[model samples]
Target: MEVVATLAGMSSSRTEALTPSQVRSARAALRALGRAGMAECDVDGQWAIRADASAEHAQSSATAYRCVHDQVVEERCEYRAGGVSQWSVQQAAELKANRAREQAWWDGLEAPERAERRRARQEEFAGLSVVEQERVKIELAERRVRAGVDEAARHDAWVDGHTMDAWVRRSIERQYRYQRLPEPLQQAKAAAWQRHRERFGIARGTPLATSRREHAAALPSTAAGRDEEFLLVDSGGRTTRRDVETG
Candidate 1:
C-alpha cells in the first residue's frame, strides 16, 4: 500500500521532475490511499507541474505515471518511448507465481504434520542460549515487518502493472522510522543493517527451515527454560521490552 513514483521522461538538468511542493502533495495523497486500501491514481503531474517548468528544466512532456504498485521500468525522464515496456510486467507475474507455490506448499500440509512442525519450531527456539534467544526474537519481529512490506509491494505490483524486486529492503528501512535522525546516523544504521544482512546471507525473506529431529532431541521443547523477556519493534520503528508470564 505504497505509491511507487516513476518519471516517464526525465533529464539530469532537473533534480526532480515535479516541483518540491507537488512531490510532497502527491506523496501525501498516495499514503492516504494506502491507508484506505485504494488501488490506482493518476495525479496528472506531468500536465500540471510540467507546464510550469521550461524545456531547460524538464527533459520532455511525457506523462509521469505514479502507481500504488511497483513499476517495471522506472523511466527517469531521460527519454520516454511510446511503446509498452515488457520487463516489469514479466517480473510481477513471476512473483505472483512464486507466492502461489509457497501458499500451496503450506496448504498441502496435513494437520498432524503441521502440529509436528510447530513442535519442532518451539524446540529450535528453546535450544538457543539466552542471548541467541533474544536475537531470534528480534529476527521474528523484523519478519513481521517484512510481511507487511510484502503486502504493500503486492499492491504496488498489481496497481502499477509492472515487475519489481521483492520488498525485502523494507524490513531494514522500517527500523529507523520512529524518530527523525541526522543524516549521518541514518547512514550509519543503514550500513549496520547491510553488514548484518550480508553476514547472515539473508538478503531475501523466506520461510524458516525445519531442524533435523535428531538435533531437536537435544533441546528442551517445553517452556521450562524459556525467558519471559521479549524485545519488540513496532511499525513505527520504535523499540520496547515486554515480559510475558511463562506460567
Candidate 2:
C-alpha cells in the first residue's frame, strides 16, 4: 500500500505509525543481508536488496523500500516548500564594484571650482542687504513720483486740448490739487481733518458751520478777536490760551 503524508508532521508520525512487528521483521531481513538496521550505508549498497532477496523475502524488501521512499519524498518537499536560497560570492562582488564606481565619480569633482560657485552665490546675497534694500525703496518712490507728475501733465494737456463739461473739469481739477501734495503730508492732513470732524461732532460729507465769533474762538488769542483774554488765573486755568498768550 502507498501512503501519503504532509511535510510538517511526516518524520515524527511516520516513525510512530510503523507497526512493531514490521520493524522487527525489517531488522531481521537487513541483518540477513549483512546490513545493520541503524547503520549508515551507501545508497547503491541499500538498493542492492532486490538482486539478493528470495521470492518469500520480496515483500519485506518492498516494505523497506517504501519506508526509504517516504523519507526521501518528505525531505525534498520540505526543501522546496520555503522558496529560499543562499546568495553566491559573484553577486556580492558585483554590488561592491558598483558602490566603488559611484564613490570615484564624486571624488573627481574639483574643490576650487566648487568653492568658486559657493562664493558667487554668497556675493549675490550680500548685494541685497538692509541698507541696499532701503536705497532701492527710495529710488522706487522717486521714480513713482516722477511718473505721477508725467501722468498729471498728460491729463492736463488732454483737458486743455478738449472742451470737457464743467463737472468733468472740476473733478479733474480736484484730483490734481490733491495729487500735488507730498504723500506723507497728504496722509497727515487727512488724519487731522478726521480728528477735527470727530471732536466737533460733524457728520462726514457735511460742510462745517462757522461764524466769525466761532472762528475767532477756535484760533489762538495772539491775534485780535471777540473773545475776552484773561490773565494770572490758577495753575490749571493758567495753561489756557488766554494766560499763555497774555504772558
Candidate 3:
C-alpha cells in the first residue's frame, strides 16, 4: 500500500497499481541480481513483466565470452559474498573478457588472413626445439582423439595405413594441436579456451577488433621472409608508423 502511494505521488495516473515503497523494495531486490545483466524495466502492470523482455534481452546480448551484465554483477556479488578479494574478481573478469575478444578476432578473420596467420605461426613453431615440436605433435594428436574431431579409424588409416590423400591434412593436423590444446589441458572441452590468448601473446583486455583503422597491424610478407619498416600516412596525413612506437 505504501509502495502504491509512493508510485502515485511520482505520477498518479501512470503508477496507480504500485506503491513507490513496494517498487523501491522490488528494485532493491533486483539490484542484488546485478549480475543477472537484465536492465531495469518500468513495471506498469503490463503483460507478464513487459512482454517477455527478459527472454528478449537474453537473446539480444548472447555472444562469445559474455555473461550478460546481470550475470557479471551476480558473479561480483558472489565473490563479495564469499569474502573473495575485489582484485581477484576484477582480474578474472579482465582475463575472461580479453580471451573472448581474442577468440572472436581470430574467428572473424578471413580464410586468407587465417592461412597467413597459420603460415606465420608455423614459422614460429619451427623455431622451437625439436623435442618441443615432438611434444606439441603428441599433445595435438591426443587432443584430436579426445575431441573426436577425427576418429581413431581415420588416424589408423593415416598413421597405420598411411592413407592421407591431401597436403592440407598435415596443415589441419598441425594447427589443431595448439588450437585444441590450452596450455594446461581441460577436462571439459567447453572451458579450455582460458589460455587461448596466451598462444597469440595477446595481453589481457586487448581488443581483437577495433573501429580505429590506423592501429591495424601490417601482415609481413612471408615469401622473402624479410623484415622491412614502412611509412604510414593517415587520413589527416599524420605520420604514424615509422617502425617506431609513439605515445
Query: Predictions ranked by TM-score, top down?
Result: 3, 1, 2
RMSD of each candidate relative to the true structure = 22.8, 38.1, 21.9
lDDT of 3 by residue, 86-131 (tens): 6666866776676578779999999999999999988987686545
Model 3, runs deviating above 4 Å: 1-83, 130-247
- Poorest lDDT segment (10 consecutive residues) of candidate 2: 1-10
lDDT of 2 by residue, 31-119 (tens): 55544232333666442333454555677778899998987777667667963223324544565566567558656769987678669
Lowest-lDDT window of 10 residues in candidate 1? 224-233
Model 1: per-residue Cα lDDT over 1-247, one tens digit each: 1123343222233444565765666566555544444433448532222114444323332333334123534443222765434654575566667657877997899989988998999899867654576567557545534333343343334433421211212222333241245677566656655655554444332222122223323433333321211123234343434322231
- For candidate 2, report its TM-score: 0.16
**Clashing pairs counted in every model:** 9, 0, 15
* Native RMSD of candidate 1 (Å): 22.8
Model 3 clash count equals 15
How does each model score on TM-score? 0.23, 0.16, 0.24
* CA lDDT for candidate 2: 0.47
